[model samples]
Target: MRMHEHPTINYPEYHWPAGKRCAVVFSLDLDAESPFLWLHRGQQVQQLGEIEQRRFGPRQGLARVVRLFAEYGIRGSFYVPGVVAQTYPGLLPFLLEGGHEIAHHGYYHERIEAIPVAQAEDYLVMAQELFCTQTGLSGLGHRAPSWEMTSDFLQTLERRGVSYDSSLMGFDHPYHVGNMVEVPVQWTVDDALYFRYTNSPRDKTHPANPGAVLDSWIEEFEGVRETGGLFMVTLHDWISGRSQRLRLLRKLIAHIRHDPQVWWARADEVAAWHAASPNRDLYRVPAHSINTHFESATRG
Candidate 1:
C-alpha cells in the first residue's frame, strides 16, 4: 500500500479520569543489581564497580525515593525484577506500605529480544508467580525490560491475565495491542537514555547533566499537556535516585502539581481508566495487523 493508501482509523479524543486534561505517571524500574547479574549470568562477576553502583539502588536510592513520594503525597508505580525482590526480601512490603503499585519487570531484567520466545514467556510466568507469592497481588501490570516485546510475548500477557503492558510506544495515550492495554513509553522521557552511565568501554557518551535533563523532561511534559497525551516518566532506581536527580524530580513534580488539570496516576490506574473508558476501542492497534502491513509493504 502507498503511504496515503495505508489504512487509517479515526482516533477519538483521549479522555482522562476526573475530567483531567492530561495524565502523568511516575514509574520506577526498581532494577537494583538484577540487570548486571543477568548480563553475567554464568560467568564470574568481575565488574565489581558497576555491580556496586547498581546495588546502591536498593541499599539507599529506593529509600530516598520513598521519602520523596511521601513528601509529595503521591503514589507511583514500581516495576521490580524478581531477582531484586528476592534479594532484598523486604522490598515489596516497603513499596506496598508506601502505597505504590508493584508491577512485573522480569525475572532478572532479561531482555526479551535476546532469548527464545518460550524462554521469555517462562520468565514472565516465573516473575508473575514470584510477585504474587511475595505480595499476594495478582493480575499486575508488566513493562518489558529494555522496552522490548514480541507477538508471542504479548499473547502470553493476555493469557496470563495481565492488566496492562507499558512497553510499546504506539501512542502517548493508552491503547490496545491485541486485547492488551498498552501504556506506551518513550525513550526521550526515560532516565536510562540520560542517566545510565557505566564506566564500560561500550559507553559512547557521558551521562547528561541533571539540570538539562530536567529541563528537557519539563519541555516534553508541556508538549504532552498541549496534546492531551500521557507523560509517562520512566526512572531507574540506580540511575535516577541520586541526590541531584532526586532534586530534579522534586522540581518536576512541583511544576506538574501547579497544573490543576493534570492527572497524576499510577500505571495500572491509567490502564484501568483507559480500559473502561470510551477510548478503549477508539485507539486499538493490534500487533498482527501491523505485521501484516509490514509484510505487504516489503513484498518481493
Candidate 2:
C-alpha cells in the first residue's frame, strides 16, 4: 500500500528593511467625537459627559500625542475618520505638518456589520475625498473602525484601491488578505482595552495602571523582537493622551530606542515594504470563505 504524500509547510521569515530584527508601528486611532456621534445618531444626545470626554482627543490629547512623537522623532500613523476631518478642518493639515501619515479609519467610526457593503464603500469614498480636499493626498492605508472587518468590507477596500489595512490580527507582521496588505493589530496592545472608561455600568474592569501597561508593552516588544515580527501598538488619542499615560508612552519609547535593531515605521511603510518584498506571496489568506464546511464541522 502506498501512503499519501503531504507537501512541506513553509513558514516564511519577515525581513525588515535595514536588516532590523523587528518592525514597530506606533499607530493611533485619532477618533475625536466621531464615535460619540455614531453611537447617538438619529437621536438627541443630551448628555455631555461622553461627548466632552471624547472631545478631549481633538482639543488637547491629539496635540500632546503629536508633541511627544515629535520629541521622539517618530513619524507615527494617525487613522482619521471623515467625520473627524470635517468637524476639525485643520486635523489633516496638522498631522501632515507634523510629518506623520494620515490613514483612513471610517466615515463615523461605523460598525461595518450594521451597514451594507455599498454604504461602507461610500464611507471610504467620502474619507478619500475629504483627505484629498484637505491634504491633496490619497489614503494608502485603512484600519476599520472598532477593528471589524468582513469579506464585504475587505472587498470594498480592494475596490477603492486601499493599499493596506491594519485592522486584522492574522499575523504579527505584515501579510496579504486577498489583495490588501494587512498590518495586524492585537487587542492586548490596544490602549482602549486597557484605558477606556465611560463611567457607566458597562465598565467591567478598572483601567490598568499606566506603569504596568508600559511594562507589558515593553515585554511584548521584546518578545516580538525575538520572533522578528511586527510590534504594532494601537493607541487612542482620548485614552493614551493623558499626562500619566503619555509619560508611560514616553518611557516605553525611550526603552525601545535603546535597541537600535527595530525598524520603527508607520503602517503604510510596513505595508508597502511587505507588498514589495518576497513575503507578498508567501503569507496569503483568502478574503472570503472558499468552502462551506462550518455547519458540518460544528453539527452534533
Candidate 3:
C-alpha cells in the first residue's frame, strides 16, 4: 500500500507563521472492556480480551503507566472511557494529581461509528459528565473508541464542545478538523495495530524482537526531528504494559532523551501551540492526500 499523506488547510485569516520544527505528542488510550463487556461484545472483542482485562485492570497496568509518565516529567493525554473512570475513581485523581490531560474515549468502549448519531451524542454527553464528575476535570478533547470515527462523529464532537481529537492516522503534525483541531497520531507507530494486525498463525502478534519495534520508532522520531516535524506515538496501557513491550517503551524514551531536538509534550499543549504559533504554516499537507478526509467531510 502507498503511504498516506497529511492534509492541507487554507485559513488565511487565522493562519500563523511557523514556530518550532516539530513537537512530540504522546497519547495513552485508556479503554479496556470488562465488567461491562456484555454491553458491546461484538465490537469490544476485536480490541480486547479477558487476559488483557486482568492485566490492565485498574491496579495492575494503568497505575504503572501513570508512574512511568510522571517519572519522565512528560504530561500526556489519556483518552479514557467513562466506565473505566466510574469503576476506578481513584485512578482519575491520580492522573489529575500527576498533571495529565484527560480526554473522552467513550462511555463503555463501544464503537461510536456503529451507533446512530442521536445515540452517539447521548453517550458522548454521558461520558463527558462522568469524566468531569469523577476526575473533577472537564474534558474538551476526544478520541473515538478503536480509532473508529465517521464524519457524523466528528460533527458530534464539534457540537459537544470537544476542542480536538487524535484518532486519525497518517500525519506527522496537527491540523484542524472543521473548527476543532486534530492532533494527528500516526497509527503506524501504534502498538495496538502493530500487534493485532501481525497476529496470525504464521505471524506472531507481538513483535518477535521488541528492540526492532523500538528501532523503527526511533528512526521515525529522528526523521521527524530532522525535518522539524512532530513525532507522536500512540499506545494502549493494556498492550504496552506487557513485559516485552514495556521494555521497548523504555528504550524509545531513552533514545528520545538522547536526541537534542525532541520536545516531549502533552497533546493539549501541542494543540495550543499549533493554534497560537505563526508557524502553523509549517504543517501543510499535500492537496491530493487521502488523509484530507477531515477537510472533505466538513466541506461536504
The whole-model lDDT of each prediction reads 0.89, 0.88, 0.70
1-300, model 2: which lDDT tens digit per residue?
Answer: 112122335577888888899998899999988887898799976888878998899999999999999999999999999999999999989999988999999999998888988888888999999889988897468999999989888888888888889898878899988888999999878999889998867789998888888889989999999999999988888888889899989999999988989888988889889989888888887777444434434546
Sorted on TM-score, highest at the top, how do the candidates line up? 1, 2, 3
**Regions more than 4 Å wrong, model 1:** 2-6, 290-300
Rank all candidate structures by their lDDT, best first, as comma-separated numbers. Answer: 1, 2, 3
lDDT of 3 by residue, 168-251 (tens): 753556766555577887766887766533233544554546667787888888788776667888877776766677678777
Q: Pick the candidate with the highest TM-score.
A: 1
Q: Any idea what lDDT model 2 has?
A: 0.88
Candidate 3 vs. true structure, TM-score: 0.79
Q: Give the TM-score of candidate 2.
A: 0.93
Q: How close is each model in CA RMSD to the real structure?
A: 2.6, 3.7, 6.5
What lDDT is obtained when candidate 3 is compared to the true structure?
0.70
TM-score of each: 0.94, 0.93, 0.79
Which model, 1 or 2, shows the larger lDDT?
A: 1
